[model samples]
Target: MKAPAISLLAGLLFGAGLAVSGMADPARVRAFLDLFGAWDPMLAFVMAGALMPMTIAWLVQQRMPRPIACEAFDLPGTGLLDAKLLLGAILFGIGWGIGGLCPGPALADLAIAPSEAGIFVVAMLAGMTAHRITRG
Candidate 1:
């Protein structure tokens, strides 16, 4: 119960932050990705802001005996950059470049532009399902 409630609150906060930061707008994200063309620097600031807190969180995580709402931290297993990782990253980058909305931004856009974002979310779920079937 505690974990589920905390998860919901965290998700809501994340969506609200994305909405407030203009990341919910696919056009804004596209503008940021357009480096040689009409590049926007606002998203860089937002990324830096996120990284600062995440850096602090990582430091804090090291000292904590256990996670607040879980028995242990579910951290990544390995740091190895392998073929599967590279392929997934390429696919994700291509999707983001063509669609201008990755998972987080797409989820954030759902409340504001349901029809468009819903299509994206459904497609994303389909891709995830395919991956699970193929990989597992």
Candidate 2:
């Protein structure tokens, strides 16, 4: 119960931050990616802001035995990058560049821009499903 509530709160905060930072806007994100064209640097500030807290959290996690709501610390394995990892990253980058919506921003835009966000989310889920099917 506590863990779920904390997760919900964290998700809500992340969504709110995405919205407030203009990341939920596909146009803004697209603009940010346009380096040779009309590039916007606001996204850099937002990324920096997010990175600070995340870095601190990671540092704190290294010192803590376990999270407040969890019995164990389940960190991702620090393994060498493989072909699958490279392919997944390439796919993710292509999707982000073309759609101007990554998972977080796309999910955040769901309430505000349902039509566009819905399409992206559906496609993303389909891609995930395809990956699972292919991996298995």
lDDT of 1 by residue, 47-86 (tens): 8889988999999999999999999999977788989999
| Candidate 2 lDDT, 4-110, residue by residue in tens | 99999999999998999998888988899999999999999998888888999999999998889999988788999999889889988888889999999999999
TM-score of each: 0.94, 0.95
Best by TM-score: 2
- Give per-residue lDDT, candidate 1, residue 130: 98
True lDDT of residue 53, candidate 1: 89
Indicate the TM-score of model 1. Answer: 0.94
Q: What C-alpha lDDT do the candidate models reach, one value each? A: 0.92, 0.92
